[model samples]
Target: MTVTERVRPGVDAGRLMEHITALAAIGATPDGGVTRLAFSPEDVEGRAYVARLMAEAGLAVRVDPAGNLIGTRPGIDPGAATLVLGSHIDTVVNGGAYDGAYGVLAAIEVARTLAERGVRLACGLAVVAFCDEEGGHGTMGMLGAHGFAGALPPGIAKVLDERGVPVGDLLAAVGGDAERLPEAAWAPGDIAAYLELHVEQGDVLERRGVPIGVVESIAGRVNVSVTVEGVAGHAGTTSMDHRSDALVAAARVVLAVRAIAAEEGVVLRATTGTCSVGPGMWNVIPGRVRLGVEFRDVSADRLDAALARLAGAAGEIAAADGVTVTVEPGARTTPVACDPRLRDLVAGAARERGLDCHHLPSGAGHDAQIVARVAPIGMIFVPSEGGISHAPGEHTAPHHLVWGADVLLSAVLRFDEAPVARG
Candidate 1:
């Protein structure tokens, strides 16, 4: 019941900003963003840097086969489980700073605060930085946490990347022993709960004039790859009526996707992020095309129906154009509702800090979604300027960052005393 604001052991806003600034320089893009791919040399170095930071804070560090970094501070009671806090560090090509970095920094502040206060929980505490949440290497997104949770399949060790290099090989080189379970370093029962602090990748908080958004659920995401194939013909000689243009067929499907969302009367969204047309030259008629379609919604069933409609539309369009169409389901992850107890804890922290807070659903995917499956999970969101993310223009002012850290500090303290376990 005690709510007091004091400088937690290592909760230095200036120091946290310094860490973010230094990490940004590692994969520093020419356009003021970062481009470090997961499990690459750059990621290896970045992981090492974070490990060093954790070590200096007097935490023991270890890396699992899935490349997750876990830093633990032992508490007085060894029988109780540990509290885990983290987000992935790998970024999309040219991604912003606060997305994944803020969570790790906030966890570090938690460790610093606990150390300074000389407050030991009944259980241990761990700070983790998961690897490759972006799926940049074509491996499983949230692979690190998935492995830790025993959700990773046994055979995924041999999955190859774009360069035909096996994941097992890569993991071995990075000091992770690929055994029966990729995350042999830790088991599912070790973590009592997990929490992530991140920037709201949308304008939700700013639009509502709130400082913090307690996530209710992480939206489900599904990707469909649609391929349209039509017979090639001479561009100039073939009559418009006789020609079977794959590009034309693909365009119709794209329009249908947009139309489906508009007609559904639901909060559903679909996007074609990538497109490929064959025959490269302007004068050549396209014979084949590939489009990447991704759909997201708060409801999993609604997302399924929308994807089904999209597939049906693609089939109809291809039939009309005399083309062969194929739809392949790619990445699929369901929405995760935050642990209610932790959600209330976050709201209480915001209220104690005299900040406006609202309960919101996260539209973007995060490592916390994966962690929630194994541990009780909560998220604290800071407002994003103009709701921009995944770009160089993504911005969160320093004050927001500091405030978020303070809220995170309070939540950790609450969890430390009255532990909640999932069924």
Candidate 2:
């Protein structure tokens, strides 16, 4: 096959776009975005639309007990492992159109092209639509991914959605049997490999003028909550030097989070995303404050070093401010490196298409990381306009989206066309 033909390989660009536009309309936002939060009515509608697309692509579709949608194209050899392609369809509040949706729709287009051409693989092709990838407004993020990995939390049945309704109930509303969630778990060999396509959600590719990124690793993330407590006093009556203020201490802790990272030349990014202060009234001096500090890095050692430095900083800040500071660590997940062979296939496809390919680590967490527990994983990234995501401005050009699919299809074909080995 000619290089151009191999790269494009009959992917219907217009049809691919049709799917994107249609899905974007389901949870349409007035400011040009979407909000199909997990388990929301809008999310149900969005998944239904994808199910229709999957069916039209000639795949047998079903929803797993954990609410993961799987559409499978039968293989030439029934005993062979399945090659899975996927991305979540749910979006964050006011999220842009292409974040998780592009990867999914693009995979369907690839499947449609393969089916129309009558090409069936030894390894069956399955497309997954993982639910709650954004964590359903913080009620346990990556729920579907954890479910598929058979790593779901024990308390899942008791977890509630944003509206205080049981998540299990919401899953049922979308055809999921929460009681049978274990049935969704795929054994180690069941999924031979997992591939995902997504927008970069950062500016690296765009700033470097690269259209495609071969993910080297998904960064490990750790979050810690720091609380500072002091005596509350009247804003007008208390002397600034004699009175204790938790907000002031918390602000210092927030700045120290960044200062430590920068001064130590720490590889991880440290952010204080939230600061809760009470009493909140303007006339009341704040007596308690909590700050959420999160750190992300490709190296676990680096993350540990960061935490150690944070502890020392907190001690100094607490003593200086005359307040008690406590640091409580939250979730900590190690980084997942992309499979070496698959990484090369994606890179080769990008080069074959004459697209500039860059290798980078993913800062944002994705389903691919969790799925890595059961199968080898790979990821492709198209440039996010200005590295924007989870907001109204998230964008990738029409052609960029198609090119990512082309690379995804080419990589899948390369893997399928090669000789197979079994343990």
Candidate 3:
């Protein structure tokens, strides 16, 4: 069937916007942004509000051991694998309103629309609000989704936030038992598919004038902490030939990092977002420098190759500048491709709605990547105003938000009608 023929009026844009506005108000900052860090009081309150919304949508609500909020609407076949739709609600510090919250709200709108229409399908529907996706309070990010996928690390309980509070305690506060977090993991047959609607978080969609982006893959990430050491000396008295300036060497490494990514093409990205210099003084030469280097790409092979080249170049630069450099690896996540079947489904839905669809790769990490381990996963992206996100200025127009939600609704219905595969 043609996409246009399948189109139907679904989500109420006005009601959806109201939900978004009310949720944004929970952690509203003085600067007009949000601060709903995961497991914070504001986060808990926001979850409570979402729970009320779930109840209003006629779904059974529950919090999993991993602190994931799940709202389920049963289908005709009780034993069928379930269709899950959701995203995280937690935001980064002073983050924008739509980053993660939009996806969760969109899922709820889909369920509400289905319930209101009395539409029943073969597979059950589950709307989830994943916790701690924004790396709240120094905790490992994507905590809830990772736990659900059984990919959470072994030492999660021992992990502490900025407040010295263990993640276990935080989980307990939110009705989750860190000791029982293992029980939250879902087996292969538990979920039929997963869907998420999010803002593009980049300028690609906006620059291209496309209303929707059907994600092709979520890029892998590698983070490294680099420290360069050199002898401190008086800036004015030290001759250029006698100086081993750490900052100078660090700057060379940063430039090299950027050049390498540029050589590798658009799929590869490298960044040095943080830099620290010791003995901050105008007259003193820098003795030590620390840089936080990050690399991202859709191909694991390409990411590894880039990291190797970067490390080699850093060593060369350090040797040339007479400085000692140390590189320490941090968090690393593999790249993940969306299910081809599901990707096409999203594209078809957008076409049916008469919206311009663009295929793109996500540069940012997402909960859908973690869930992809167990189920076929797909993502829908709406344009962020001026390609801004993770800040107060981040926004997707009201109509764009509604359009993405409508696409999500269409995709969910299509999944429900498909035949289920069971082990």
Clash counts for the predictions, in order = 2, 1, 1
TM-score for each candidate, following the candidate numbering: 0.93, 0.96, 0.96
- Candidate maximizing lDDT: 3
Query: Between candidates 2 and 3, which one is better according to lDDT?
Result: 3
Badly placed stretches (over 4 Å) of model 3 are 1-7, 263-267, 419-423
lDDT of 2 by residue, 239-344 (tens): 9888789999888898889976676667558889998998898998999998999999888988888888889999998899999999988889888988887788
lDDT of each: 0.81, 0.87, 0.89
Residue lDDT tens for model 1, 1-423: 354543332267897888888877778888888887787777888888888888877789988777788889887788888888888778888888778887887788778767767667677888989877887767777777777776776687788887888877767755666674543435557778888999999998999889998998889988889999997778889999998899999998888777767766444677788999897578888999999988888788888788788778877887799998898888788878899999998998788778889998988998888777678888999999999988888789888988898888888777777787876
Candidate 3: worst 10 consecutive residues by lDDT? 1-10
Cα error, residue 186 of model 2, in Å, equals 0.4
- Summing lDDT over every window of 10 consecutive residues in candidate 1, give the lowest-scoring window: 1-10
Give the candidate order by descending TM-score: 3, 2, 1
